[model samples]
Target chain A: MLYPRFKHFIEQKKMFSLGETLVVGASAGVDSMVLFDLLLKLSHVWKLKLVLVHVNYKLRGEHSDLDEMLVQEKANAASVPFFRFTHTEKSEGNFQEKARTFRRSKMEEVLDQQNAACIALAHHQNDQAETFLLRLLRGTGLKGLGGMKGSSLSKSGKKYIRPLLPFTREEIEAYAEEHKIAYRHDASNDDVSYKRNWIRHEVLQQLKQANPKIVNHLSHLSSQLREDEEALEYYVEAALQKVSISEDFGKCSLKREIYNSLPKAIRLRLSAAVFQKLFLESAILSADHREKIDHIALRKEGGKAQYFLPLNVLFTRDHEKIYFQKENVSE
Target chain B: MLYPRFKHFIEQKKMFSLGETLVVGASAGVDSMVLFDLLLKLSHVWKLKLVLVHVNYKLRGEHSDLDEMLVQEKANAASVPFFRFTHTEKSEGNFQEKARTFRRSKMEEVLDQQNAACIALAHHQNDQAETFLLRLLRGTGLKGLGGMKGSSLSKSGKKYIRPLLPFTREEIEAYAEEHKIAYRHDASNDDVSYKRNWIRHEVLQQLKQANPKIVNHLSHLSSQLREDEEALEYYVEAALQKVSISEDFGKCSLKREIYNSLPKAIRLRLSAAVFQKLFLESAILSADHREKIDHIALRKEGGKAQYFLPLNVLFTRDHEKIYFQKENVSE
Candidate 1:
């Protein structure tokens, strides 16, 4: 029943193509092991070309190598193609994040080398919930709160899919147990630095008392918000055409009448879009910053209306136009 | 300094006008008491008319009567006119919610009688945070996550203001203590029944270890989402016009081509709005339900492609028009 439902969800979401080469990102964890097993089972039906990829960061010394060996052994036993990458780089600040970047680049490289279609990950509902709670606690907008998608195209135009996304971690664990799938668990991770681990083990557990189905609830909210974000992006794009009169290397100008005429949400989003246009990668715009922009946009417009954002982006309004200009664009 | 900042916030937000009649909802709690004191001080500067209104549900025995007496006594000491409403009705199921409805209607009645500009409540950042968290935990879309506004108009177009929304409970308590303001405390509250109280006292406390500024973050996120929701609503309204082909007595027909062309978020929102139009008030459409609709809309177009939502709303699609009809309209 679970297998059928999982396949159905993947088919309904149009996550992947049958018989296409898929780079499976397995970490020797229960989720990835279960994911690998499911895909192996699925291969008989859909004939999906499975290429198992693992990156051993070697953080846990012997345990890490054993983790890599387990994945390799599974791949060898199943008669599947496998690729392994070792992160020999000296462990430094933000080991998890840096390792993730290294791992993804390596996986994508394999995809390029093997002409594989997309990378398949083992991220599930708990991961989605943890990510949303982390983003929420860290203070993010709709885009961040929207959490992960089951299938998405990356910035490099490469595709990735998470077939296990619709299921919870408990379900995956149950499946792993039922199928007798061997997997390794990372023991004694640094809870302080591994913020997501802390959230998964601590925060979400505590939140469950508030609502027993916190995981599923967060997952549902995130997917709903994801759709919301996609829709909002469309609206933002449409409003950008009307509200923004002109843009340059360091400056974006807008028509206050058009901006104010729109709803408050669009107005704020337009301001954000204009800000993003001026400085491609800017600092965080706090809610207070948005409030200030909302204030000055409508207040008696003149040259006196000038506010500086965190990135030295100067917002100035006049009789004709409201402008956001980067003061030090050369940097 | 707090007073000045508070006044500035009120003025900047355009929360109130000078010398207008304002009905203050006083519950004798610290929040309402502090609010009453603030408005009283403001009246001297702006020559405003302050009418204090308190509702006693009479559930807490003589303590409830004492709460009323204290509010009336403070109003008398300040020489401000007051109105007190006693909940003479028997206490029944969902006492808090029913009490709130009864209280608000009575307050609004006062506003109508005195031609008051707005009913001022003492909802602060904490209230905003709780509402957002509750909604988020309960699995809500962006609209629910937007939470409450600082100032808004009711269905009847009567204005209500939350002047202290920018401040936290700690700040309010500090101000109350500094000013030697006396306030009542609800001695015993049922943590099980009072969901917000449980969230306020327990859930929020647990979340603070993850982030100390959780309340403020939730408030900021809600405000940001408020803008996002408003913007999405505008887009939904726009898309609603283009996609929804026509509406009849108990049915709405949409264009499959148009609905499929729009982003996933708008399609879901459009579906909710259409459902609202047909049934007036309907049960929730889950994310799964939305996925099904999204599937049917773009899938093979025929009479066979039909989905029934909660409350007997039938969704069917053909080549040109997709229809949503209330199956049990007579009920």
Candidate 2:
């Protein structure tokens, strides 16, 4: 069931093109193995050129090597090109973030070498749900709750695709068992980040008791929110265009009438963008800050040039226009 | 601390008018009782005429009556008008839902009798979090995940306000203790709905181990999503205005080019709204349906008519126009 659905998702999302080369990230885990097998089957239909890439952080000593060996053997059996990166550096602070950077850079290296259209990773439904829950727990806004996308481009311009994003872990395991795919157990769970483990083990499992399909629900929510965020970003840009009266160096004035006519969400996003464009000092605005700024901007009079945003951004709203300026300018 | 914040939330949201008569619902639980006390204090400053409404569902027998008595006693102590309703009728068939309906209608009845502006309910932050989590577990969309609003109008044109929405259960309890506000425990937890109990006891409590301030995060997400949903609704309407070529009875034609130019989120929403206006049969479109419909409508020259929505709506797309028509006419 999930096999056909995976193919359908790939087609519907237009994640791949005919004969497009892809750098596939594998951890020898069941999820990745299933993704590999699914893409292997899809290779003929989509004419996809597949290259498997694995990273051995060596944090798990023998376990990491064994995982790499299994993936290499499987790639050889399938006659697929394999790229293996072995990390010899000592593990330091922020293991997960650092490892993520190391792995993505290595994959991009392989991606460039192969001239692949994109890198494909095995981030399945469970992973997305866990990320969403983790973000919700730690506190997040609209964009955070949107979770991961099916296909995204990195800041450096390399594209990545997640064909297995909508498939649940159970479905991946089921697909793996049905095909007798060779995959490793990822015994390195002990070294995995605490927050991810807490979410996957404690939060998600307990929530599964409430609903057997909670992962699917969360995935659905993530997909919906992502679409929503896209729409919001578009509107915010449009609203910015409508409201901006003029933009000079280190300052932008927006027509208060136009800005006030926008929806609350778009108004807030526009304000944030205005600050980012003019000052760039207010890296993040808390909900309270946004509300206060919006209060003054949208208020129908009695508020003038007395509003202040973080650090050195001055907010002034008159009957006609709202002006934001950088107070401190470096020479 | 919560006292001032509570007042601030009400004023910031413009939840009430000066000297406006308000019907507040109290369950004798600490959350509502604290809300009752806060409003009692704010009554003078805001010149609010307060009427406390309590309903004893009698499902918990003696406990329910005790709750009513405690609320009535408190109302008498404050010299505030109190209206108590005792349900002697047999509680059957979805006790919680029925009790909620009965309670709201009774409260509204009193509202009309007193010419009150709106009903103020003591739905605190914990309730919002619990609702959000429970909805997530049971499966929900972006709107469902948005949870409750601070001030909302029911379909019947009556308004309801939740002033304590930003205050957590702990905050409410702490405020109650600080103010020496006497409130009953409601002693009816045993009769509460199973799903709510499961979520409150299992999911949220387990999640709290990961983040003690999870409630605040959930509340924050809800607030942000609510704002997002509002923005989405606004954009959908705006896009509809641009794309709609004609809307006649049981039919609507949209400019396919214009529709495709809009964001995916707004396009999907516009399609749903079109179906609602034209056929009214497709009450809810699943993600799959929306994706399929969108695929057909946006695909260049590949699809012409033959798209079917629920029961009796036909979706058709040509080179320039997307048309929808109701298939059945009962009259």
Candidate 3:
């Protein structure tokens, strides 16, 4: 079903010209296995070379080693380079953070040794949806809830690409089954101890059952939101051009009469933009915070007044002007 | 807690000029009851008019009549006009659809006979959130998800104002309790059978508990989205000026090379505008539908081809020129 999509992904990546070297992050999962085999089959047509990298964090003992062996065997059959690393640290301290750090380091090491152009990962649509939901549950702003990008530059300037991100897990499983690809299953996915596991197994499943098309609906929502968010960033840039001052203050001082003349919504966004620029971070600003700032700016007897923000930035209003400065000092 | 807010609302409404008028649509609910007593107390300062309008759809039999009596006694004690309505139809259709139609008709009748300048309703922040969520779930585009406006002209050209929309239900309940005002309970709110009720009782409640500031967060999101949406509409209007040919064909013939040179997200939105203009409807385009249309436009085909939309409009392309004409066509 997704062969055309996979072909499109390969074409988009210019995979054939990547020095015949392809680095795949193998998790011993069905999705990764399917991707590994598909790349292997397309190797001749695309004039490709394959490198498989597997990282076992020693969290699941013998099962982890067995999973690594399965990936090594698959690479051996395809006559490709296989690399495996076993970490002594367990998946205990911030499982996601630790795993991410370890995986990136290992991928970078393999890429450097092999002189690979890009590192490929097996993140799919379901994972993206999980990420979006996770961020939303934590009261994230729009950018945070945009899930993951399909391509980005790694810390060492190497390319990281997710070619399978647009496809679903079921599609991958179907492909694997059709091709008779051998893959190992991770038991941790069913443990349900982690928050992501809980959401993946419980909340998402329930939502899927309630509406079979929930994943598609949510993915569509996220894509639309991403577009809308890009448009917002464009406007914020425009608003900053008109009203922003300097990076240090990040303060846009406008005539009180002029600021008030703009729409209430723009006034709020302009305030948010100023706050974000001054703090050098984006956090959710409450309606109360917005109203307080509005009140301060519009105060009849406006002396110097200060309001505290999340990142210890003080928003100060003196007469008709508002400025964001560090929180330690009193005006 | 909300007394100051109520005071601000009355002053904002310029209620001093309107004397001895009825506060219609008083179901003895928290919103209406709070508004009723606020108007009664402010009668001295504003030389105000206060009356209660109650409509009994008779769906709940004795419970519905009891709600009406509660409002009548409340208005009687305040020594204001008490108007009661009984619906013969009982609104057996979609509860929301019927309630809205019947409520407005009743409001129109009272406003006409009593010469009331405005009909005040007690919709508050929670209602706005529910409205936004509903619009989101149903795939409404930007404008529908903007929640309710502060003031609007009713179908009959009467002024409709919502004074409490910025305040939460808790604030109104607190004000009612502090002022010793009696209110009726509506059991339908807890039904959980209706989609809106499910969202209100389950999803919103959970969100509120988890964040402890969900309303403010949602309101901020809404305001920000509204600003971004307005800015996008401005851009769309500008793009339309350059590209749009006619509404009949939804005919927007952009220079293909230039359109393709624009960002993919903008291209999608511009395409949506063409679809919207031709369809003359909102919420018709899904992500898949959009992708199909985009694929056709971006395809390698050099000749004319037809793409059918769900709304029965056919998009035809001839090399660099795109046409959104009627479905019956030999492209």
Best by lDDT: 1
Which regions in candidate 1 have their CA more than 4 angstroms from the true location? A189-194, A243-250, A283-286, A300-304, A309-313, A326-331, B189-193, B243-250, B282-286, B300-304, B310-313, B326-331
What DockQ, between 0 and 1, does each candidate earn? 0.74, 0.83, 0.27
Steric clashes per prediction:
1, 0, 2
Model 3: per-residue Cα lDDT over B1-331, one tens digit each: 5767777865654433546554457876778888777666667676767656888878778988888889888877778788887776743457768777888888878877887777888888788777766665565445554656556676568887777767887888888788888887888888987777877777677555446777655654554566556656766666666675765544556666666554456667777887776567674576567767677778775677778776567777778876666565566
Predicted complex 1: CAPRI docking category = medium
DockQ: the better of candidates 1 and 3: 1
Per-residue CA lDDT of candidate 2, range A1-331, in tens?
8778998888877898899998899999998888888899899888888999999988778888999999998799888999999877776687778889989999999999999999999998888888888778888877887878889999999999999988888888888888888887864454434778767767677777768888888887887888899899998888777645444546688888788888998988888887776665547766677788888877775856567778687788877888887687587
Top-scoring candidate (DockQ): 2
User: What tens-digit string does per-residue lDDT give for candidate 2 at B58-175?
Assistant: 7677778888889999889888899988776675587677788889999999999999999999997888888887777778777777868889999788999999998888888888
In what order do the candidates fall by DockQ, top score first?
2, 1, 3
For model 3, name the residue pairs that clash: B20-B49, B21-B49
Model 2: lDDT equals 0.83
Question: Per-model C-alpha lDDT, please?
Answer: 0.83, 0.83, 0.71
lDDT of 1 by residue, B1-331 (tens): 5678778878977888998999999989999999988888899999999999999888789999999999999999999889998887876697768888899999999999999999999999998999998887776778888867778998878899988988999999999999999998887643545678778888788778878999998997898788788877777788777644444547788777788888887787778877776567755677678778877887763655788888877888766778888775574
Model 3: per-residue lDDT, tens digit, A1-331? 6777887876764444634677899989998898887777677777777899998877788998899889989888888999988777654567778888888899888888888778888888888777766665666555555555567786578888777877877888888888788998888888876667766877667555336665655555666667666765665566666554665544445556655554455566667877766666756567678767776776667477888876676777766666666555555
Judged by DockQ cut-offs, is candidate 2 incorrect, acceptable, medium or high?
A: high
Cα lDDT for residue B328, model 2? 68
**Where does candidate 1 chain A have its weakest 10-residue lDDT segment?**
A242-251
> Model 1: DockQ against the native?
0.74
